[model samples]
Target: MLSLYRAGYSPWHRLAAGPKALLLIVIVLGVSLLPVSWPGPAVAAAIAVGCYAVPGIGLRELRRQLVAVRWAIGVTAAGQLVFLGPGPAAANTTRVGAALVISALLALTTPVGALLDALERGLKPLDHLGVDRQRVALLLIVTITMLPVLARLAHDVREAQRARGAPPGLRHFAMPFLVVALKHADALGDALTARGVR
Candidate 1:
């Protein structure tokens, strides 16, 4: 999604990153606050699809991107169904799904560098309050970049476990994955300290 956002040339791509970030936040909040109904979420979903359908973001690539998050989307949808009992459950689920789709579209259409730059500038006001805006911005960038890395590591670990005939279950996978992640975190910290990033 991050790659797709940075890959294409379009009106969305041309918009200033700060405005784009603000727009995303506003849309997400507006969607969240809307009464449980079909129209609002349906419209949001339509807009999300439209954003992806713009020139240069072919439907094929959109499908590919969505496929990558299929598991997460499925989990979220299932959780909503199970927890948001009866009545407005369907509407709630749909709204949650639409919000996910909208967020994915934003990431798919916005570069990571642009997001970081915008975040840095946007958070500048906090400097007056001694908020360490630069450090906060760096942390945001690191967190964003770590998502894909952690995902890839998890994928690799899953493949390795499968190769060893381990069944697919959190009980079988959780401990090892956590240990590996902790090791990676330690190594990352060491590297950052070496580079005087702290």
Candidate 2:
């Protein structure tokens, strides 16, 4: 799930990050502002499919994204079912599913450095307000990069606990995971200090 980028000579891959980001924002807003009706969701789903048809988005990548969101899709459907009945529930679920796909598509197609560069460029206007665009871009990059690392660390900690015959609950793994995470933070802090980064 973390290594979502796929190298290819597709049009999407060649597109500038600024334009891509703008298009992504437009698509997301269009989908979100749609009326919560059958046709709206259906159209949204079709748009998502069209996005898949764009170059670089292959069946394998699509399938991986779908599989990754299966749980969220199921839970969303179930919740909407209870509150909105079948028709609206389907519409809402489809909208959410399309959004997830679109997000994954963007992440898979764009390089992190490109995204950061784009963000810095886009946010440059805010510099007058004392907003540091470069700093903001760096923070965003660190956040995206850290999420998968933390997830992997948690998975590894859980596996290690299981191997040691520990119980299945999070309680058994929490302390060790916290300790390791703190050690990771310390090392990162030390590195930053040595590099004269505030």
Which model scores highest in TM-score? 2
Best by lDDT: 2
lDDT by residue for model 1 (68-173), tens: 5567667766777788765466666556655655555556667766776888899989989989776687687667556545655667688899999999998988
**Per-prediction tally of clashes:** 1, 0
**What's the lDDT for residue 63 in model 1?**
64
Model 2: lDDT of residue 165: 86
Which residue ranges in model 2 land beyond 4 Å of their true spot?
1-3, 142-198
| TM-scores for candidates 1 onward, in order | 0.71, 0.73
* Cα-based lDDT at residue 152, candidate 1: 51
